[model samples]
Target: MKTFKVVVTDWEFENLQYEEAVLQDKRIELVKAQCRTEEEMIKVCRDADALINQYAPISKKVIDALENCKVITRYGVGVNTIDLEAAAYKGICVANVPDYCMDEVADHALALLLSWTRKVTLANAYIKEDKWDFKVTRPIYRLRGRTLGLVGFGKIPQSLAEKVKPLGLEVIAYDPYCPKETADEFGVLLVSLEALCEQADIISVHTPLTEGTKGMISKAQFDVMKEEALIINTSRGPVIDEEALIEALQNKKIAGAALDVVEEEPIRSDHPFLEMENVILTPHAAWYSEEAEKEMRSKAAMGVADVLLHQQYPKYLVNKEVKETTRLNESLDQERYALLTK
Candidate 1:
């Protein structure tokens, strides 16, 4: 009858009502904190049996300091904040809500793409400045028969392809790992990254933040892009080298860019993108909607509750390679638990 403690390491949610309600029936003490640094994480999470995280550094130092932690569940799809390898080595489970906000992000990305393609935002700005001349916004091209290059063909891009299909855009993708058959289902043709860059009228990035993908869209990629090509990045910012993008935009190497995420959060006042009319910027808010937030919070808390309470198998295990060694599976004695790793 030991009561386990689940701590929220960091969050931007206005309240913890959904998480608290989800864990109410379990014998868990839910604690919330706004930990920014590893020292703060180590101090607040030392005794936690499970943790729910968002944007907090769960580093090797913080992991080694834990006395009895078992699981770390993330609020969103990305687990870049948590040290997955360190947690796995410590026999802890790392799970995430991988499917939430797919639709919302796809919609936002499409909106950004359209804003650039149709000059919607720019035209609106032009009208507001007391300029009523329609001829001011010129050179608008038709979307039909134009190639839309998707940098990743994952869930969000799949949704994006489906939504953008009837818009007369020819969708192509550049995911070295995406199955060609998967792309074919959405009428998207998988191409080499270079080919996508060379052919696309619009390039929308949807890749994750991995070491291999940190600067996947750097100078080399930008060099091959068409002069009229526009890029949209709703994914992680560092994926496109900021310096290279600025250079490209300044030199007119590419037409423009629409970005939801920047390489650095809360871009500084003097950032070059601010002075560029060809660029559109929105705070990293692609994965927002009231429904998505509630789903993410509750599902994240439920993941913690499931592992701590020994409920069904964790539905969204991130570090699945460590499933066999996870403390939660090792401690279970039920014959049914023998199939846990499967």
Candidate 2:
């Protein structure tokens, strides 16, 4: 059995028992390291044959430094921190666990939406302050009969729409990529982005970060939303302009917001959003249920195993072109060896 060195970064060594169990059967030795700086990452990853990274930046410099890296398995769905183009150029296959957390994130989005609409957090605060008079407190609206605007009608949005529909809420979705028939099948109104903003009683974002979607929701988008509309974002933080969101929240341009992500993670203590009672903030944990975490880790490990075994491309490859190139290279190498031997 050929032993390979796999480096696991940004993981607590004691907590990754599942990863250890997977590695035990693969003849893969695991080197656990926590990187705090770019320099540390480059240094630690220099001799690794494969990397299992979570929240660590695999920059071009680090990729170039890795002399023997065959695969990079991102521990979660998002690979924004890694330089994917560079990894592809270096002939390193990148893989991510995309499906494990979809349900968790959708559930979190619904939880946030309900919390904001029902004033659960605010009511808790009021009770703590000894303001128990129900008549004097502000009224909370029931979610039934409200319009929910979904920014992207992807798998997570589709799942959420199904859950929301039975609750008597109308679902509207805006996705340039989705066809009208697809939306109709889910009982969702296929509306324009502008229409969603103007008409929805609650808006939730579930789009991936791309050039067109980066900072997609800015001042103009926020200005068009109903003043009573509650915005919820459990997707990437940069999708919404943080400055614009803060301004809108401060001025009461929208009713309230529940954010499971922020532009700057572990948001600074002095951040203005933290001071607002109308805003409910969670530390980017929408995708982090215990079951989801375990599944994600195991699936990511499977991706690494598939690549190391030189098997057919894994189902969760983000870059299909990379796998094609790898297969082509292997075929050419076989042809050359056969020619020399014959």
Please, what are the lDDT tens digits per residue for candidate 2 over residues 1-342? 888888887874358777775667566888889986679998888988889998878899889899998888988788887888888888788888878888899999999987877788888888898988665336677778889999999999999998787789999999999999999999899888899999999999999888789999999988999888899999999999999998998888898889999998889999998888889999999998777777778777766666675454554677666864576223223342222212
Give me the runs in candidate 1 sitting further than 4 Å from their true place.
327-342
Report the CA-based lDDT of candidate 2 relative to the real structure.
0.83
Give the clash total for candidate 1.
0
Pairs with backbone N, CA or C atoms under 3 Å apart (clashes), candidate 2: none
Per TM-score, the best of the predicted structures is 1
- TM-score of predicted model 2? 0.92
Q: What is the lDDT of residue 143 in candidate 1?
A: 88
Pairs clashing in candidate 1?
Answer: none
Candidate maximizing lDDT: 1
User: Which 10 consecutive residues of model 1 have the lowest summed lDDT?
Assistant: 333-342
**How high is the CA lDDT of each candidate model?**
0.87, 0.83
